[model samples]
Target chain A: MTAPAYNKPLLDVRGLTIEIETRRGPAVIVDGINLTVGKGETVGVVGESGCGKSLTMLSLVRLLPNKIKVRGGTAVFDGRDLLQMSKSELRQVRGGKIGFVFQDPMTSLNPVMRIGDQLCEPLIYHRDMKKADARKRAIELLKLVGIPGPEQRIDAYPHELSGGMRQRVMIAIGLACDPELLIADEPTTALDVTIQAQIVDLVKELRRKLGMSVVWITHDLALIAGLVDRVAVLYAGTVVEDAPVGELFKRPTHPYTRGLLASIPKLSDERASRLSSIGGTPPEPGRRPKGCPFAPRCGLAEPICHEHVPALLSFAEEPRHRVACFVAQRQMMEAA
Target chain B: MAPANLTAFVDEDPPVSLWRDAWHRLFRNKLAVAGLVIVIFLALVAMFGPWLTPYDFLTQNLEVRNQAPSLAHLFGTDDLGRDVLSRVIYGTRTAFVVAIVVTTVAVAIGVALGAIAGYYGGLLDRTIMWFTDMTMSVPNLLLVVVINASLKTPVTAWMEAQYQATLNPFYRQTVWVDFLLVFGSMALISWPPYARLVRAQVLSIRGRPYVTAARALGLTNRLIIMRYIVPNAVGPLIVSVSAGLGTAMVLESAFSFLGVGVNPPTPSWGNMISDGLRVWQHYPHLLAAPAAVLGLATVAFSFLGDGLNDALNPRGSK
Candidate 1:
């Protein structure tokens, strides 16, 4: 695949390192990560749980949990550095230019607030719309999210709705201001499979209609295969491979990414066959291996794999397909 | 399901807000309902006690002095010939006033300080908590007694001076001095619990995902606190206030019985009970009248508070 060159990306994050305070001392959770989402692009951030996928997205908006600090990062959105922006400036950017849909819709929404009020909150605050106008927009937003009888549903509390409906409301709230980018962090994890497909389709349809960039964070690669334009596979708080969706599936160069892709049970697999899975778990935050975080789990590990961390390098043929693995790079070089 | 049928189950009844939901839960609890009814009845009686009382509580009928329960006087007459029933009704008024005033002042101060401390933790939280701890460390009765004893004389003298200088009837009203001392001292002691309750509430609520969602919406801190945090935090506060009202009434009665509460002629239950105690062996009616009513009020408030706590926090119950 030919690389789309010369255009500046919409959001460029470089050397993003996030740390958490522990009893002994501070430990790195996200270690000098680099990522980019282009204009009108839908990028899937696929990772296992605790791979810092959610943390990376949250830190872009300076919404990291207490005692977890962003040690170093430059997240350039539009033209300004998001990390360096003042509080008021950041406020203008959040829910105005950038939207967020959290994982658990059940707890993420305010239970006491009516759906209408929650929908209108951003409109009133960020857009400075009148109450009546915001109410009208809220109903329209409810309709936009395919909620039945939006006029009546607007008055319902969060508890009154089913999980899928609540997630749709959450998405409506995220899209209330017609933001330039939407950061959805596992928005479908808590939902059932069919409902998850519906949400994905809804997001895809909405993105097509609105032309907004989306950073879809999820642990399910198969779920986002047809939805995202590109995929960034995260393993142990670092991006191991990033490529166009088709290319990533065709050539998963990183051992971690390959293992993740292989783990997704395919329809052609024999019913009685054992599902393939990578041995060993991701290292704990404070006790991570010195060289490569994935080396201990990589079947292709050599003596040097434990001595030096592999830097993310682009494939010689396709510049857009980047991979971080010493063995993979050496094999490709030997093959050439 | 089709879109129409999808909402059918949820749409059968009108949507209920959180407050209405809580109210519904409260009404279902029979003990809470009974308590609520009694509290309302007492409050109404207190409001209209003067007009409703058959005889003046203070108007002495010398012929009826030391009488037992009789047809004309329901609760009989006291040693001073005052109607025991009328005095008990007036005592209700005193209890209600002190409870309402002290609790209101305490809640307001507590909510403000607690919200600030909880929202902005660090030196401010430490300082406010330190101050709260210091105030709580002092014995409540001792603090009130000290305040009243030390401040009452000078305040009364100042009121007298002002009455002489300005000839204002308001200044001449010495009962105002008693009320000011009682309210001020009680409010000072009453606030710490409320402050602690609210602080703990705010601390827990601050970490809730909805609050974080609110911040993500670019809402100002003030809006988030008022709209998100405070509304959620207020459920426990309501239960506390319900219980605190009863506690305040008892505290007032105790202080008055000890001669530090509202002075004589106000017909406070505490003072009335104190007076009745002197001749209780001869006339048990005197002691029983005021004591029974006070006990009833305390029990009613406690039941109501317990009901509210259970209703507001349904998850805590089975």
Candidate 2:
């Protein structure tokens, strides 16, 4: 329900809960969370590590790791509940309707396989393209991702390519079947700064050209500033703030969002000045606070903030911006 | 379409496939090269033993019953005056056949069971591993001896009955019984290690990011195992298989020497060495010829295995 500019949503997730089996028993990792991605809209899912950002996305595709599972969720992608789909139907959606580009390009790609073969796998399986045709399409995808010498590079293994080049190959593979939604889970986390910028720009350009909805998951608030249309700020497995990109940057409502944005160092600061950062890490999954998960870390927490969790509500004057913080609600416009 | 000028940086290096790279690394190893040469030479000898041997291995001449090494017979004559060189050459054929066939059978069984156990963990994994452990726990020699002792008479009798009923010459070769028992026992014992190795390999390889990536790509588990998991897990397997071949050859010789394997007149190196052992004081050539050849094959395989281990996992090498 972010911005509501594009009403027809491509993916609408509701009350998605995930649990991990620990030594004690099953513990809730991702509490009841709601998220949605509109058709041809780019949304950035920003959160720190272990905030259930990656796990939430992985659970939608039924790719959760061993001992971790979806407790309850209804992930309706293209008007179908993905969590309840048959194995065959899930196969059609995975890499067909919703593509994923994972983190750590160096390790994510199969080292022994040729880059072309890896890129062509989904096309051959889902698109039913012949190997020869798949190969041609693979070359085109490599070119589309801006890799040099598509013909020669097609035969090269993952190790033969540089890290940035490997990531490009990964993106090309994700985009192979022309999925409706691309969920990039910290795709630029492992790249050099310049390379990260290039990849972000490339994804932005690809999103424009293909007009596919993108869920760019990252902890860096600054990286996806220019890449995403709206930003959803997650804290301890729950969305604390959801707003248009420009509005979120200009007026970060949630304490967690403000902390995240403040953490990004600005150039105008003194040469020797210390970079601002959130003092404490986000709460662990199962050990999250009974009330507001961010109350312990927030500077402006009131008595009510400690006693009860704040619901995400839109401001009366600025209906597009939604924030989940009691102190902000009382200080700012009325919650409508 | 991409700009043509953007592709200018790709001219520096040529493409090299993994197989080619592994071969290159293998050839660079001096000990491995030597092993390869000896293995190839022995394989050729095994393939063309009949043509290469100067005399029939079973032929006996009383006059030259115990001759030393000479121009006529490079390895001299045994107690029966049968040319030792011909017998050793024929022995090479038996060793290679037993080694290759047993290894192939064992590897097939091992890879299949291990891959299944690994890909689908929990009860299936425990069950297969339990079976593998049960098989491996029993002493190999004791198992083979028991099998031969218990089953040989019944199998030979069955073969005779079949021959009598059908008038089929195929069942007349009772030597098939000895081979069947030996090959079956050796393969049964040999597979457990391969199973354990491949299982461990698959368990690790399946968790890799590439495998997860493949899963995210919506590939079936079978396709993931065959194309993705198998290729990556094959390096250590190659090393294990090479070592297993040598071990199988040695095991066959031991069984043959114990009279539980290939019977007499078959010219197995083990039986020849057994025949040579008692009369070695008078004619050392009898024992030396077959023993030396067995030692050479074992050493050659070991060297090749070590070389392959290093070459396949180059990061582990200095």
Candidate 3:
């Protein structure tokens, strides 16, 4: 991936391992994930369902579900290790320094609560603002999110708002304290296509205005195509390829990434052709194939690819792009 | 420009809260409104019984003894020569007090224990559920009888002794012993259902995305519970508590009828009915007033509970 144009690592996650306690034993769900988001940079984490994309972000905030344990990890945010922070320290960081916008706007907001109160929660708690001040700020936040008649809307409950409006409220809540980093986990996945584009646009506009680092987790490659500065493609919990968004689109080096890109139905394709799909599912948590987790699914898998796991290596020709594939690495090494 | 600008017209109707919405729905049901009116009437009678009653309940006149229903005495006089109307009015006070206190105690215990058990889960949950099951398994009337039979005399004697030693007028009120025993015993038996309901509620709510979102917002567990979990869980609780008030009143009456609840001079409907039962062939008015009032209360609360259940959970209604 290209060096942060901001030249400061806002969030650096290394060897972040997460395990879920299944009946069998502790199954490795997220195995040594390395993710970094620079200040003012929007990084899109792309992966299929159950590939630890959400889990990776959730674990950074120590918000993993019960029975899921973080075995090892160091998520350094602004020189502080988030994983090792005390409850009090984390509380200040959460919603203050690092805001989170969760998926499923319909369910993500407290249904019984007023949208204004929900928006004002982080403000009151993090900033310790007076109720009147918080109310004023809540209206401002609602206005900032482009909710019509913010004053009148503040008193409205979650059920009264449309899905798009509710998601906008969620975004408002995330941006409440003017957080340095906003980790939005597929915030627009539940919206309609038109609404999704609008949300992307709103986020793009907000990002330019707020100048905060964003880590957007989603399965939709095309949706985040123009939104993200860098893209880290995860396959079965590992970052198979990480590169600048433009470079990744131009030449997706990892087999899984290529397969993913191919799967996206293009307008240039024949109308009758069956939409290309990656064959077989990603390996299960407890039953990851030895060597590479993607080896079984890879069409160009060599005997050596099955024998040894490939490390993420930067191509000599394109130092900014990295690919975790033995075949891709060998091919690049031969060319160089 | 003004004609086209009409699209920006804001609807000025007040925002509808869940509680307000539920209120509107509750009022829509005819049976519920009737029940609410009857309950309100009963509550008013209970609140202002002393001022409203024509005669002092304890003041007896042999001349008016066993008088039939007339303008002077609406419900008729009992064999004791005591004004039956006044006694019935006072009985309303007893029922309301017993019902409200018992339900409050039971609900407090239930909400606290249930929230803890559901939120924490594991061993705490297992133990609490086990305790709840154990409490529910025992017969309610039997448990109240056993407690009253075992403790009533001792408590009254202790109060008498305290009055003698301290010269405190508070201890002289032995009727409080009857009330305390009834309240405690009834509360003990009544809390299980509430605990179960709230535990189930918290269990379901614990995994909701909003709760996860709340956690992500770094809201404290207490705040999350108070603001998020409790409000969502309270709708069913309100319905249950309405029903519970009725149940508590019925339970109190049953205890008083069995000579285990509020004693004489307190004018309880249960004891009055018990007294009226023996000579029902001669003077049916004695039984009719208290019995009718108790039945009315039970039905009122039941209808209100049903209405609340429908209102809170709109999906459950037509």
Candidate 4:
């Protein structure tokens, strides 16, 4: 009775299936994906293009395009199913309890509107504050986001601001209501390396300061390596492997995860044969492999691996370290 | 809350209210400004035209009939010996009244219907649009004539019957009846285009992200349409409204020129010119003055509308 056996995860996504009604048929984009983020924990999702990582995050907030529909899922956030929430209810949760930072800062902010008005919009909508109060809060948020001279910048339009400044404004808008969870979808992907690092640091610093859970979705592994506590590796439309940050990097269990790690250039390696790139591009939506999505690129692929789909299997050595591969464990055993 | 001192952080273009910006742009268009000035001047002339004139528009003078323009009569005497200048000035008041009233009502009816149809976008949109199309299908000239003829039949018949009983032919020939006929007919035929224009504009603005953002904020649909949709769509509506004003004025004059517009003795520019054409060999001033004013009014309105379109565009500003 002295201590509780376990703590519930902040965002528990289980068996989430997303299908897009294509010209062909309902093609599954996010197939049977499951993951968790503990309270104040940062979970980084990394995958190549069209691997359903961004779609998976968008699905959580019910922000997917009209064609891509959710088939089956339980995005249990603060004891509520996001998939089942009414449009109005979903809106209340979105930008209120769960903030979203989109990738393209250029298109995200309204071109015609002043930055202050855009920031104040949510406050007036969700908080029911007076216009003056809303504006004051917006100024405070602008200042918090490190926008210079919040007083004058509030009246400026989106076009007047630089790229870095605009992204900062996007983050400020995301953190407007002091949300419990932040879903940042490739927030810094459009920016330069130095600016990307700055944004990553800002997010990490904000998470530490506010004690809010973050699901940072990105294609850049190195960026996530420094910021996130855990890593969820996605392939095609599913999470191939998930483990604590250190364990996933030290011993990547899935072939896709190993391929992703190998692709990254190391400072110690010679320039000639330094990086090992993943062969073949991600599969198109409708034409997916019968067995495993990543089996075509797997070096240890066998007849069984090609014939049967890999289930997310736990290892005896580290139960938390889950990998969806038939031959990864056997290969590890044989090598030892 | 205490009145908080609001300040802009970035020193850029001095912060001005949205309406102020619209006004500035509207005023800057040279043609629109000129048109506005002409309209204002015409409005003043129309208002004070009667007080400035000695003879009434309908007063008949057999002795001074068919006289040339001179300082004594100034604009000369008509067939009834009324001063041409006085009659012309008085007629302007009628044109201004009809143009202003028709344009206002048309914009009001059109904008309301258009906003509702475009924003809702279902059965209401289809029904309103269908009615507009049906209205538009009728030739504008035929529509105006039909409205005028319907109004005239009962009144003309009643007056003719009274004249026959009283043995008096003079009472039926009057200008007041003609002004009423023109005003009512022009208004009826001119409103459909405005309604259709507003609907199209509303449809475009409704698709914008700000409008969607307003909805997501949980603002009531009515408020969202009124506050955001209508305001954003005003840029187009304003241009339409200005252009419609000019079109309606021309339509009113065209109706008059057809003898169904303003009646004889009222001295409306259209009928005045029409009358001058009948006896152009003898009286040229009647045609020249009215034609000049009519042309000037049309040009002014067109210029103003064009100017407004340019001014309201923030990107258009230097």
RMSD of each: 2.1, 2.0, 2.4, 6.3
lDDT of each: 0.91, 0.90, 0.90, 0.78
- Badly placed stretches (over 4 Å) of model 3 are A1-7, B1-10
**For each model in turn, which proportion of the native inter-chain contacts is also found?**
0.52, 0.64, 0.53, 0.08
Interface RMSD of the candidates, in order: 2.3, 2.0, 4.0, 6.9
Question: Least accurate stretch of 10 residues (summed lDDT) in model 1 chain A?
Answer: A1-10
Q: What TM-score does each of the candidates earn? A: 0.96, 0.97, 0.96, 0.77
Docking quality (DockQ) for each candidate: 0.56, 0.65, 0.50, 0.17
Query: What clash count goes with each model?
Result: 0, 0, 0, 14
What DockQ would you assign to candidate 3? 0.50
How accurate locally is residue B21 in candidate 1, as Cα lDDT from 0 to 100?
79
How big a share of the true inter-chain contacts is recovered in candidate 1? Answer: 0.52
Docking class of 3: medium
RMSD of candidate 2 to true structure, Å? 2.0
The most accurate candidate by DockQ is: 2
Tell me the lDDT of model 2 at A109. Answer: 95
TM-score of chain A of each: 0.97, 0.97, 0.98, 0.94
lDDT of 2 by residue, A1-336 (tens): 233347878899999999999887888888888888988889999998888999999999999988998988799999999999999999998899889999999999998899989998999999999999999999999989999888989989888888988999999999999999999999999999988988998998898789889999999989999889899888888889999899999999898898888889988889999988888888776687888999999899888888899988887777768999998888775443
Candidate 1's residue-wise lDDT over A1-336, tens digit each?
233332678999999999999998999999989999988888999999999999999899898888999999799999999999999999998899999999999998988789899999999999999999999999988888888888889999999899999999999999999999999999999999988988999898898889889999999999999999899999889998999999999998998998998999999999999999989899999988998999999889998889999999988888889998999999878877
lDDT of 1 by residue, B1-318 (tens): 124555565565778788887899999999999999999999999999989999998899988898998989999998879888999999999999999999999999999889989987899999999999998998999998999889999989998899999999999889877988999999998999989999999999899888887788788889888888888899999999999999999999999999999999888999989998999999999999999999999999999999999899999866
